[model samples]
Target: MAVTYLMLARLPEGGLGAFDAYESAVLPLLAEYGGRLERRLRTLDDRVEAHLISFPNSEDLAAYRADPRRSAAAPLLESSGAAVELLAVRDI
Candidate 1:
């Protein structure tokens, strides 16, 4: 069973920079966990700022979530006040 994880993020004010930094450091770590950057940076609207990322499976997604690198990046994301919405879907 292959699962997909979709992450939707709403960056806080002055958070894009922090998000960028986090992404730079965490992206590779994600790959190490069997996750691929299906969508790195995506712009939702000109006025609103948000991003969507997809992972290959739940295992990879979980690995990314539990990774120490991700832990390190947590503060930056928190400081940026980024809102994260996660959805996990198993392939039918």
Candidate 2:
């Protein structure tokens, strides 16, 4: 079965200056890993974001996780002092 994920994040004191760059880099890469960005939402504060993502399967998810290029967003996030939470969703 396909797998889904929920992600919530809080950005740094400087706010969303780097969000566009991060999104640009990460979103395109998803297709290569059989992943999809279901939805992305940003708060009015511009200091937080959330995502709904899905993947073909656990293997695809694992491959994406293991990819070094996947860390493309890491610098933006780390420098921003971001806080991220991810949850796996399964059928009820």
Candidate 3:
């Protein structure tokens, strides 16, 4: 079954640059796993970023999560002091 996820990222004030770099590098990898980034949003203050993403199935989502490139980019997110939350969602 197709899967959708809501990802919320809380970024540190001083680490916005790192967060941007991290996302720029990693977000593209989703496509390799049959995933799409449906929507991406950010608060005016740049404190929070929200992503609406979908994958062909849960396995695809897991594969994306374990992608080597994404794992390599983890330090960037960690260094940015970003807190991330991911939730599975269903359309109404």
Candidate 4:
């Protein structure tokens, strides 16, 4: 079964750029693990950003999470002071 994720990130004013850089670097890594980015959105005020991501299965998603490339980008997120939330979701 496929699995989907809803990621909501609260960005700090100073860190938004850093967060964007992080996403640019890491989002592409999804393909290596049978994953895709369905949608990405951001508030006009730039305070929040959301992403809809899907993977073939939970295992693939887990592997993506463990990928060193993604891990290496952690500092970008940390420096951006972004608070992130990821949730599993389903389409009705």
TM-score of each: 0.74, 0.84, 0.97, 0.96
Write one digit per residue (lDDT tens) for candidate 4, span 1-92.
Answer: 99999999999878889999999999999999999999999999999999999999999999999999989999999999999999999989
**Per-residue accuracy of model 3 over 1-92 as CA lDDT, tens digit each:** 89999999998889899999999989989999999999999999999999999999999999889899999999999999999999999999
lDDT (Cα atoms) of all candidates against the true structure: 0.66, 0.81, 0.94, 0.95
Q: Whole-model lDDT, candidate 2?
A: 0.81
Error of 2 at 1 (Å): 0.8
Tell me the TM-score of model 4. Answer: 0.96
Model 4 regions more than 4 Å off: none
Which has the better lDDT: candidate 1, or candidate 3? 3
**Among all candidates shown, the one with the greatest TM-score:** 3
* Candidate achieving the largest lDDT: 4
Model 2, 1-92: lDDT tens digits are 89999888888768466765666667788889999999999988888899889999989988887778758677865666678898997657
For residues 1-92, write the lDDT of model 1, one tens digit per residue: 45556666787567777777776777778667666556545575412343334556566677778888789778887777678777764446
Better of 1 and 3 by TM-score: 3
**Which consecutive 10 residues in model 4 have the weakest lDDT in total?**
11-20
